[model samples]
Target: METLTNDKATLEVQLSTQQKLIANMREELGICKEHKAMAESQSESRGAHLLELKAQLEDAVLSLEAAERRMHDGELMRRRLHNTIQELKGNIRVFCRVRPMSSLEQVGADPDIQPALDFPPSDDLLSAGIILSAPSRDGAATLSKHVFAFDRVFTPEASQDAVFEEISELVQSALDGHKVCIFAYGQTGSGKTFTMLGSEEQPGMIPRSMRQIFESSQGLRQQGWELSLQASMLEIYNEEYKDLLSSKKLSGSNKSTKEGFGSQQPSGEIKKHQVVHNPDGSTTVSELTVVDITQASQVDLLLAQAMEKRSVGCTALNEQSSRSHMVFTLRLEGVNEAKGKRVSGVLNLIDLAGSERVKDSGAAGLRMKEAQAINTSLSALGDVIVALGNKQPHIPFRNSKLTYLLQPCLGGDAKTLMFVNVAPNIQFAGESLCSLRFAAKVNACEINHRKKG
Candidate 1:
């Protein structure tokens, strides 16, 4: 009986051990279920965050596109408004500039020589009018005052930057698809060339204008503007048009002839060029050299080349006087492929020959002939301006090569600005008066409204 009781106790111990193992397994299964639920919740949260990020990215992309579109529209509006402002100022304008006397001129100057030119004290009048006091021809001590007004006037103290500020708007017009003409007019030694083709230390209108165009074009690239410029330079010498950029070398005799004011006959034959007026109101010269201007520096190169080849001669009034009217034409062709728009414009920068009289210039023989030709062309230009100012039915554009070539700028839908450069010296008082009067006439003349092409 004792052996049977011991066996029953061992059986009971084995049963208790198996029940403890079952309880441990159930606890492990419950913990695994809780971990699975937490994992599922984390996955859902991660997916929601991803979707939110995607939506934000999409919103940012849409905003960028909208801003770009607005930028493009704003650029277009800017062009139109800028052009409108220019028109309101005037389609035709004139600015008078008086250059200071040279050091050589100041030496041994007469103490009795009083100041001939005076500026008004008022800021408004200072830029618009100049007073000239000259001694009467009767040899009296009395002074005759002549008051003249113009669109703008620059005194001797004005900087080149200051002068260009007033005309920068006109240069912008050329880029906006309007024909622009800016020319310097004055007698010899009166700073016309200095104003137009200033020294490297002090760049003039042509270089400054080119730099402005380049800078502006680069800025407009973001708005989808692509502008290409073509430049051509020519000179009208003694009623004859000569391409200043011609590759043909001028014969030694030809050079001598020009130096002596045509005292010797030219052995080399000069190519004849014809100016053709297109049905579209564009003027082109036959066989003219047209160079593609990719950079503003190219213009400087061209100016240097032209100056070397241009017709210059010695005269009594001024040595190395420009004996020809130099015309530099920059043709701008721009397109915005994105907007499906295109434009064509031209900028004509002319440096007219000095308008001094033959007697004053002390020219004889062939030189006299050259002076007469220059005077005739200038007279023709004056006549054309007078006709335009009167709004006549017929303008005499064909009266001279200079007038005919500038027909579009003077009479067509173009913006024209004349710089009447003058000398601030008692000796040049008469010439200064004449230039101011002529500039006044030009400022009064009006042309057709500008239409963008």
Candidate 2:
């Protein structure tokens, strides 16, 4: 019995041990399953992360390719536009430059003295036109608002560089062996001089143009081009031509004689020259001084000398008024060694005498005559421009000395650009309107064919 009891105890003890072992195994199995489940979740998360990374990389690559394609398309478009502009002949383009108020004009003068020029909003792309409202008289309703449109309208705040950028293409046309003419026209004190021949610090169209031509010629040399540049300066005072570069002097004082056909007799030989027409429709003045220029600084000096010799006088309209029309001609001759081709181009830079009203100019003696001559020439220029705009069969080219001299630019295949400078002052509104109207007429004229050499 004792053995049987001990055997039972041993059996019970073994069974208890076995049951504890099974419970331990169950807990271990649960821990293994939980760890396996956790491992599978981590693997799935990593797999998804890798797929997302791959998608992002592919997207980045596609975006890069798209940007490259856009850049290529932009480059191609730019080249096409450049070629088109080069092939197309530019018409007579008119640009309006509005002069800022002078120090005198801005001083504690009456507010009414300010111009009625209405500038467009800053963000407006189509704001290149100007609205000139008639002055308010006795606080009455304004008479009219003259809206003038131009190819370009430069505000008073426009920089000299900005103005030149618009016309630099025309300068390039001359370098490409096309005749180019640029002239500034306006009333006295309307900033024609400032636009054409700005101050030393500013340096206007004439100086900038010479530098551009010089730089461009250097680049062309790489293409086997040999360039020759010649410049001549002349002024028409009272309808006569005076060589500003001539060494001959007037008989009396340092003041040169008023040169023109129907003007007062010069004390000495006025260095007279005759205008001859070539069979090819080119015109040249006999014995015109043409200086070969290698550097732009030489042009600066030449312009300075001409300005010193220009007829300027104080008038009620302008304190330092230019009393005559000045024309500076740059002749460019280019030879390409590789092509064995030669090209000659003419660039005419003109600063027209401001048209002044006799009553406003308060002229006496010689100034009165100057006013008459200037008005007459400007009137004739108007008639020629009007006739040209009207597409008249016989455009009046022999109306006045100014028009006659500009016949090639006005009537021929030359590319012409005119800068209509307008004063932004109430006192000069009428004159500005007239000047703008004349420019509008010029802009309307169309030249069918342009000679590219």
- Say which candidate scores most in lDDT: 1
Taking the tens digit of each residue's C-alpha lDDT, what string does model 1 give over 194-250? 888899999999999999999999877867889988888889998888877665644
lDDT of all predictions, in order shown? 0.80, 0.77
Worst 10 residues of 1 by lDDT: 254-263
Taking all chains together, each candidate's TM-score versus the true structure is 0.83, 0.73
Model 2 spans > 4 angstroms off: 1-90, 111-115, 121-127, 136-143, 250-271, 449-453
**What TM-score number comes out for model 2?**
0.73
Q: For residues 1-453, write the lDDT of model 2, one tens digit per residue.
A: 999999999999999999999999999999999999999999999899999999999999999778756764664475456434633544567788999987977895587544568865444432257888665546675646788777689999999999999889888777766777798998898889888989899999999999899998876785567998878788989998777875456422123211111122245544465665566555667445567789999988888889888998888888889999999888788897655678777788899999877787898899999989888988888788768656789877787887887676665556778899998877687778778887877766656532211
Stretches of candidate 1 off by over 4 Å are 1-50, 123-127, 135-142, 249-270, 448-453
